[model samples]
Target: MLQSIQIMALPLQDLKARIDQELDENPALEVLEDRETISLDSMPEKNSEVESYFENSSDPGFSSSYDQAAADSKQSFMENALSKPESLREHLIWQLRLQPIPEEFFQIGELLIRNLDENGFHLEDPELLVSQDQHPAMKEMISIIQRFDPPGCCSADYIESLKIQASLVVDVPEAIYPLIEKHLQALDRGKYRDIARAEKIPEEEVLHCLEILKSLTPFPGREYSSAEPTYVIPDVAVTRENGEFRIMVNEEEIPVLGLNSFFDQVFQESGNNDQPGHAEAKSFVTSKIRDARWFINSIQQRHDTLKKVALAIVEYQRDFFIHGPKSIVPLTLKNVAEDIGVHEATVSRLTRGKYMQTDFGIFELKYFFTNAVTGTRKGGGSYGKEAVKAIMKEILEAEADRHLSDQKISDLLEKRGIKIARRTVAKYRKELDISSSYNR
Candidate 1:
């Protein structure tokens, strides 16, 4: 049961892999092809008892529903068959092939490419490659490759990459290169005045150069990454139609499975035989048939449980879907578990790594579960932690000229009846990646 629930929690691509593994291991399990449909008539009837069993079984009804769903899902599957993206190494190699460099230089270039890390910076010392004889030509090749499409392909570090990229700009400020070379630490700490004092330039001029420096890419190679992108397929989709939220489970990717008719016929035939090996064959066939039935039933249970949990979550967080994350109320796994008449562990398993697509955006199912932060004032309503974070983010964004300290932000929230501590405000700011008031 836990394994089945875990399977339900998997995203589309992962679920497909799991299904492929099961099909390889279980002979009784088989995927129905596009042209094939499982029906009672498809199975061979060797006797009255076998025909009676087929008529009373639930397999025919399940197959009918599976066929209908499969027909409706064909177009969606085709639409989702996306093409693979090109990587950074392939792009660089193509450019190198087009160059008129010497054939021997190509080997050196390939070595240089191998030394470059994912961020487009050289991992090994370039001087290590050159002896006294090939020093000048090797240095020239390295320089040429550095000036490739990314503008900083073979740099040693971010400072070197920035310098190489800055040289490409026609009207780059003179102070920009010196600042990048000498005072990178100060620049990171937002110390513009220190840079101005050292360079004997005005503070405003230092600020201007800082703006230009910010425009350069620190990791140029990451822009054309070779890694294959992982796509997310939402398990549930919530859309609004005429002011009502409807929850639809994304079962289009799941394949319908059934027992092989050949195996079913063998099982029926072996049951009537009285030969020496007939008893053993009959036992084996019965076991396979039972395993196949259990596998199909488990899949159906997983489908039903996913739909039930999704509907309950949609009903519980209706206000959030309508008004956005700000309106989300405090919720927990226990609340959803009790609502859906399932255990807390079951709810947790269902939500793990599962995502839902809403009219607002695609969000993880666990995103809706937030702890309640009590208001300071008596008789006031409690606020969700996510709601408080959203409010804090809004306050920070609107502080245009004046920089608000954590204490000041806490006071502002208190005025709005939130009563969060200054430390809590600072922690939230860090989580949101907002710098301190001094840095701002």
Candidate 2:
């Protein structure tokens, strides 16, 4: 048998946004005045006070003055950082206009600016520009922009950026200039002996060229913007005080909500009204009250769900909470969902945009769930990949000589309990920004 079953659920915050979108398209929806707007400067100073309320399309005869009243007192923090600065080419073109280059070279400089990369490299081929323009003026402009400040600001790449920097020193040896212009790769590779041999110069001379090279900023444009530090507001704060951990929802920042009491009285009294305008006013208040109550309830539900999920995480990763990162146990979303008797997706949704503050650090709820090392008895570890990464970090930290190759670290981990291969170890090491043994 086929049948249709209708189900009803209150809207979450995002669903409320969708409802608003729908209302924009729907003709029947209309905004009603809230209770507070009715009372103003001309009041008799009686005991009557204005109340807040909210409404949706479905309801027609309930008034809520409490829910909206609670939300009127809270504040939100959502400031964003300033955007990154402009590219190096934009900076150079401004500088180029001041120089009295020939008319032909000035156009070429403009062409060169168009081709410069974010790192201030001249990416466009001069030969291509010269052939297409067939004008000495265009070629001349390109060259002028190429010679703008930061030297290699318009060069095709870092090599040019460096060469331009080297050219600024009038007394720089001719041989040293060529070494930087051509053998910059060898210089970066610390192939001092090879560069010196090729240049027929002493290693000491190569060092001097490198000293000059080191003075230039490869990405000079980055210096334009001041680093704007962003502040993170934790959804939940868990701190240890007096030998016990305390869990608190940071409700101070979230909007509080309650129903309007005066509106509720109006709804109760209006159902008995036979008067013409009285019924409509009652219906309006009723709808607003329902919406206000639903919004308040949804907010409460969001908090409740977050609390359950976070508490479960704390309990499962007890060692991590007690100690720190290193003690983090293997855990997964399924582990948490099953423990909470909710679907994994439900657990995921509850945690999606939430953060927890602890003595260890503020972290995303999902950050605690990671793939395990050795499989658990039921097939998965109760710990997170972060825990495994922490284990690898610990092994490398205590390693002899303060450094260990990925292979050696893998071997040491296998001796303990982690069963990862050398390649996996290398992968994790790379993720941790641990350089190769030689580099370290």
Candidate 3:
């Protein structure tokens, strides 16, 4: 049961890889059919007969060809297949080549850039990397590379990078430089009032500076990171038609698995044999067949749970399915578990790393389960945390130039019968990555 729970938590790519590993290790498990690896671009062009067959085919595997609910899944997965990402070093080197500096300067610049790590911080001291003859030019080379596209590469640390970036900003506040150099630690700790008192600046100005600091990229090279992009293939899909929701498990990615006929026959014969080592052979065959069947059953049950959980979500949050994400109401794992007659942990495992495709967009199954916003509503209905965030975002965007404070936003929310504290509003604002009113 624990192993089954563990398997259910695996995302689509991991699950596919697990099955492939089992196939390679177990000769008894055979792929009766598999469409998971098919390159849609290279698929045989559908003739009239193929199209007709696809339209009428009773075989469930052909659903990817004509399934309305999963059509987006097929198209989305194909488009998401990414090429290798460009490395940080490659990005910096390319910028260095375009500088048109002296040959020695260019050489030293390339060396400094190469010495930098993925975060664009120096792997070794720039001064130590150059010879005595080249020491005078090291500062120049480092400075040049730091001015590359990411704007803060080849720095001593994130603070130095931030300071460099601050220096480059046009019309930057004088307090900004000192704030980065001296008060960055206080800023990170959210001790805005203390920093203001120490610096003898207005509290509002300190907060404004904090927002500016937040805007700077701490890990500049991450923008051009070589880390592979993870592509998501939704495990389940929910589509609405005629004001009704349809739930489907993404079965296309799962291969058709069956025991090898030869292995099955051998297992049957081994049970009846009396030759030498007959017991050992029977034991091995029985173990393999049992393990194979367990694996296949686990995969099926994983999807079954996934589909059931998705259906329960659609039914429980029917408003979300019909009207989109903002209409999503408050829900929890316990709520869905009760609706589907399963344990909360069972629902959690099935929903983990699982995504659902909807008309609104693709969202992880975990996204639907949100804590309710506490407080009295004029209409007596509770709000979802996510729905509240969405409403807050809409309010902010619609009044972009207003630069409303958290307190003001909280007041506005109250007018709409959703009462929440100013601090909660501030927290959600940060979560949405919206700069404070000072920065806005």
Candidate 4:
């Protein structure tokens, strides 16, 4: 049961990998039907003769052109691969190779590049990286790396990175350094008056300098970020049809599995034979059959539980499906457990790593569950924390001359019968990855 629960938590991609491993290890288990819809990019050229293979889709009146052997070969040929992007270190090293530098300096440059973090800022002091004898070379490497393609890497921090880029680039405003060092915090908070008074400069001049610095990125290495977008196959799909919601567990994503007749016949024939030599063969066959049956059954149970949980979610979060993400109400695993006649642990495990596609977007099933917001409004009105966050997001995104404060947002929520504290609003704003009003 524990093992099955773990299997239930696997996403579509992980589940597919699991199935592939099982098929390779156990001859008794086989892909009885797997029909995939080929996209335009994957489709064969005109006048080409190729068999169509689909995974987890119903037959669309097409047949496989390949025999069993050919089918096995095709499955091996078509492997899924996740592409990786160029890393910050790679980008720096590539540029370093093109530079006309000594071997010692080149090695020091590679060492410096490796020490830099994702923001193109050094993880440690450049002087500390090498021995005292090589300190001078390390410093030279740091400067060289700072002047790399990004023009801001190998610095101590974003503050230093901005300064480094400004030095290398032509026509940098003289006021750019002071503004970034002293008045950046004030400028971020819209305190132009304080900045102008402190620097004895006009507000227009301050704004002009800030605009010039905008061309220089504080974190230059981010442009070559290796972080790739996570691709997911939604395990469930929620569709609205004729004023009703349809909750479907994506059973078509996994291939239909069945027992291999060859293995079955061998198992049966070996069992009938009384020869002692046949005992080992019969025992092996029996074990393989049992293993195959359990694997198939476990996969089916996973889908069944996923569908049941999805239906419960759709029924409870009907407002979310009908209206959109903001309409999602407060819900807990305990609530769904009781509704589905299962334990809270079962509900939690089933929902983990599972995604559901809706009209709004694909969201993890866990995304639908959020705690209720504190302090009910007048007449006992309540709000989900996520719903309140969505509303807060909408408010912040609306056209405005100035950024709204956390307190102002809190007041706005209160007006809509969603009573929440200013601190809570700020917390939610941060959770949504939105900068504070000061940095907006």
Report the poorest 10 consecutive residues by lDDT, candidate 4: 48-57
User: How do the predictions measure up, each by TM-score?
Assistant: 0.75, 0.63, 0.74, 0.81
Q: How would you encode candidate 1's per-residue C-alpha lDDT over 237-292 as one tens digit per residue?
A: 99999998777888777788898788788877775689897788788778877777
Question: What range of 10 consecutive residues in model 2 has the weakest lDDT sum?
Answer: 1-10
Flag the better candidate by lDDT, 1 or 2: 1
In the range 317-359, model 4's lDDT, one tens digit per residue, is 8898888877878899999999878889888888888899999
The full ranking of all candidates by lDDT, starting with the best, is 3, 4, 1, 2
Residues 81-118 of candidate 3: C-alpha lDDT, one tens digit per residue: 55556688988888888887999898898889889888
lDDT of candidate 1 vs native?
A: 0.81
Candidate with best lDDT = 3
**Tens digit of per-residue lDDT, candidate 2, span 74-110:** 3221122234554465677788778887665656667
For model 3, the stretches where C-alpha displacement exceeds 4 angstroms are: 37-86, 91-111, 124-152, 158-223
Error of 4 at 228 (Å): 1.5
Judged by whole-model lDDT over C-alpha atoms, candidate 2 comes out at 0.66
Give the better candidate number (1 or 4) by lDDT.
Answer: 4
lDDT of each model, Cα atoms only?
0.81, 0.66, 0.85, 0.83
| Predicted structure 4: lDDT | 0.83
| Model 2 stretches with alpha carbons more than 4 Å out | 1-118, 121-151, 155-163, 166-216, 225-227, 260-266, 274-284, 375-383, 395-403
